[model samples]
Target: MTAAQMTSTSAGDGAEVAAKGTTEKRRLEGSLGVPSIVFMVIAAAAPITVIGGNSPIAIGNGPGSGAPLGFLIAGLVMILFSVGFVTMTPYVKEAGAFFSYVATASGARMGVGTAFTALVTYYGIQIGCYGYVGWAIGDLVTAFGGPDIPWPVYSFAAIAAVAVIGYHNIDVSSKFLAVALVCEIGIVCILDVAVFINGGPEGISWHSFDVSHVTDSGFGIAILYALTGFIGFESTAVYRDEAKNPSRTIPLATYAAVLIIGVFYTISTWALVTGAGASKARSVALETVSGNANMMIDMAGQYAGVVVRDIMQVLLVTSIFACVLSFHNIISRYQFTLANKGVLPAALGVAHPKHDAPSRSSILTTVLGALLLLILVVAGLDPLGGVFGYCAAIATCGMMILMLVSSVSVFVFFRRHHEIVGNPVTTTIVPLLASLGLAACLVFILVNFTMVTGGSMAVSVILALIPFLAFAGGFVTAAASPRMRGRFMANVL
Candidate 1:
């Protein structure tokens, strides 16, 4: 089959065609520029505020002051993976995202698996963010004399806001995300700088970067958790059809996003150590920040004055909301794309004729998020532990699997295409090794998921396995459908 006729099957019909030969007009506008791409990356990266603000507290108390080292190790591994990831972007030419890449490399079954896993992970994370937003908003509201609202109310409010924003033009959302991203990064940077200026009680310490600290028993687990903070970095490719000169923009953005997030995290974690004192950092973090992110603002107040602290608090809330907005867009798009490809119901594939956005998909995602919030509120579960924890764990598992599969797809694509063989490091060696490394990390995270979160082994195991099950479901469905099965293999191989 020629590459031109192998495009993805539409919801209405099942047929094999090569992607290269198909002349379907691109529906998405290439309106997103570098600034917009940067905004998307930052919006996706905003969740790190919560992760960084709390992880040290969890680890310092449970695992020790070696938390910073764990972050550094994870950063290094991600950097290695990014080297190959950026290299692979120029080769793949599909808007189906990672599913397209996996299809081209591993055939229809794996492509379906990849797409399903991504959908589960994206929506799970989106729903998960609602709980965090609810908790954060509840704290903010209670401080202002408002009644202590239930988490579901806050979550529902957040979903409503996101739905309104998400059903609009991409440019509008991009601009909104850009502003929120700046505020989030600025607040975090201020905190980091304050910690540095105040200096540690014991003075500067290099122990936070020590290899021994990173190799600790819980260090790998910590690293795995830390790695999730960078989960959305690879999504640069998700905008392939909507990016100007994607061959260049996608690869550069991918690498730049990874490096930026990694450095930001390493520096931020290190600053926290210095700000809180290496010896007492963990204790201070747990006492202050873990239960309430506002504690960080209080610390900033003591060290940098009340004005800065108040400003930071406002920014934190905005950051959390921005993440809610960003993930809503991502999850909705995943649904839209998958539905267009016939994996999901066609209703989800319908783009708003006027806005050109996936209106139904966005509404579905927002509704699901609101529903999850209601369930958690009714159950009286701690939004943090019950909702956020479960969602984060599930999302992490899904993202890790996606990364592993993409890395392997990179290797397979290069091996089969052969045109890129001259650059073995970029095409074959780097991704192959990165895939193996990520696979090991994936196994480690799965085995230790319960210990890392201090949750029940049964709960953690079930949550961690959801993405894999989603993938298996897709594979099964694809195998059972002759049209899908034929189209997948014919185009991919």
Candidate 2:
């Protein structure tokens, strides 16, 4: 609860230059406080996107009325994960987040491997989001009697928009995300309240929280989907360099993001179940998925009338845009940090002189996104079914790996630094427990990977290996270059 004082190491090259009274080396400029940080972090989660898109699939495939419990459980696990995660924030000061923390606690080589995996995590999720939002935009246009535009066209346009925003300073992106976050969350909250007040067809039953429902046969699948909705909550730590009081701000923002995501998803999902009676929830969800209908839209029409439903439809697209924009900024910063360490091209390390933003890296991210979109399109893959489904599964698997490694790093780092005193429960026990929990989540995703991707087990196995392959890629890059290996060691260890 005391403010985390910035140590020399934690302050990074930016502070070093500032202390030396030189403007020769430009760094990212920012003064973001907790609220702004939370806005960006939660924006990545895309509240409306999850409730409208992921919720129906989860409800159909998983525990039916018990889907709400899945989110609640996932939230609790992440909260435990954060206990140790935030403990390391005061120490690992770079924007690399997962990779930086693991590198500091573990080793430079392992950190590089983690860095590769982190890239896969962010890129996969962002690309998947692009596919989804593009498809959403196309659908919206066609609904209004306009000619049906190809999804990739819209996807590329969205990539351009994100690239433009990301090319500016973090402050610019944060403000844009704040507006989108409020509007999206506001609309969902209005629907949630409307559903609760009307008491739905089932008279506001709490059957969704029943123990029997939660422990049902499809609980694993339910948990996996629910956990996906919390994907970007960990990005809170990635904004460390730009934050006003990173030590305290990072922890507070992280906790707030997780709590907000957890509480919001749990309530909104339960409302979905309540809007349609518990018995009918699963069937309706299945219908929504199979028939390609929007359950939230239908529910809104029923509870809040047509105008609200139409507005929800539009906000859904904006929610996805915000999600991708947040990821674009995060990935750019990761590239910036890696470039600074010589893990990537030196050009990527330079921030824009005027904007003090990762302009070069942001451009790199945009180009990668366009290329990914082209690859998916050329493969003749369906945007939602193929791109979103496959990529999201890959991302979910990769993120779980990052979280698990990060938790272990926390434990290892504390054990090695015996002189650094802290609470055993927060610093030690919770991390180990979190690792176990996250490991289980990883296993669940692998075991039921087919359910998530909705593809053949052969494809599932291939997609699931991407994260590990990316990790191996990191190791190979480090070993192949002695200079880079030395650089990694000098910077992290």
Candidate 3:
């Protein structure tokens, strides 16, 4: 990647600015070549598998056979949003991911708030995956006469394993994610092919893509839920420091990941509808899959034989683990970046001397994840419901905020910098409108979060408030810190 032009400012006395106020070295040593980039893309896209594996069943029940239309609508909206998102990457240089975009577009305080909110959201997601991994392992073990392990035990174990992987070498994690991703995509493709060949229950219907379905009440709800599955796709920019050619690679990966994920989800959701039959699809999904994690396995056994079913279950387990590893690396890197920037504690910025990895941050991330897992298990909540639902909701909110900020940033940057507008209608105006649309979506999801997740009002309220609280806490801490107080004020003014 081309190095960013370094600019320095000096005081009247000619002394250099404090290092805290300067940008840090591009210290990421790993080379995220095309293969590794693909891994990152797929890992971020893995939640789509879970969504397809689970939510389609719920959507089928709620929106009838028109559920695929929801995925299509969400995918199209994300595509439009990506146009603005990809355009802004070349203009921003921070590694705090979306938080950095917000900082550059808005101001230091808002940036800090965004960073803290993102940290909470990403960490919650990483920890949330532990519960999912544990639940999957626990179920698999129970089938084999193994001792029944509690969800927290499995979660803790997964957290420890991910920590080790995340703290050592980026290449190692990328390779592991690559293997799991191939397996996941392969299985999903196979299922789609089988569904097509067997023919749909009621044949392909144009109603599946109708605008009315897109406008349905449950359709918007399902689209919001479906959009969450694609949350991590934006992380491609997070790896800019490590990318081979960031300007080209980041934009390419960003757009490529979104399109690939959108296509995969669209095809898979359609296959699911056809496999279960249009009229009975919802009931079939609920009865056979939503409540039962093994629904895919059972379906594979019936249509594709025992071998495929067994292989799919194994791949599903690996996919979940890959997601854990991916998010662990992401959250740890965010901590490392923020710490290095003096926005967080310096201790988190330390990298392993030999490994050149953020070892300390990784360990701390795992510890936080373990604590969250323990708290949920002790509270007697369903691990999947509490961990995935809560974390996913919060992460979704954080990402939506980031997207909104990035959209406005695009318009402002172009306007202020006098950059020529290319296709202003599609690029600027449409995305600005989409930003407003997404903001409305965010508020709707937050207000009716319980309905979206099928959780109690209290649980939904708490989960929805957590991101805001994290943002507030970060702002308060930054304002009070002796180290940051001066810089914060200077940057704001």
Leading candidate by TM-score: 2
lDDT of each: 0.73, 0.87, 0.70
Q: Taking the candidates one at a time, how many backbone clashes does each contain?
A: 12, 0, 0
What local lDDT score does residue 254 receive in model 2, on the 0 to 100 scale?
Answer: 94
Off by over 4 Å in 1: 1-26, 51-54, 58-63, 288-295, 486-493
Candidate 1 lDDT at 73 equals: 70
Which whole-number lDDT from 0 to 100 does residue 100 have in model 2?
84
Q: Which ten residues in a row have the lowest lDDT in candidate 3?
A: 6-15
Candidates ranked by lDDT? 2, 1, 3
RMSD to true structure for each model, in Å: 3.7, 2.7, 4.1
> What's the CA error at residue 119 for candidate 2, in Å?
0.5
Find the candidate with the highest lDDT and give its number. Answer: 2
TM-score of each: 0.90, 0.95, 0.89
TM-score (C-alpha, index-matched) for candidate 1: 0.90
Model 3, 55-162: lDDT tens digits are: 554454457567777777778778878887777666665445676666655666666777788887787777667777888878777866889877677778888788
| Model 1 lDDT per residue over 389-428, tens place | 7887898889999989988987887677654434887777
- The TM-score of candidate 3 is 0.89
Model 1, total clashes: 12
Residue pairs whose backbone atoms clash in candidate 3:
none
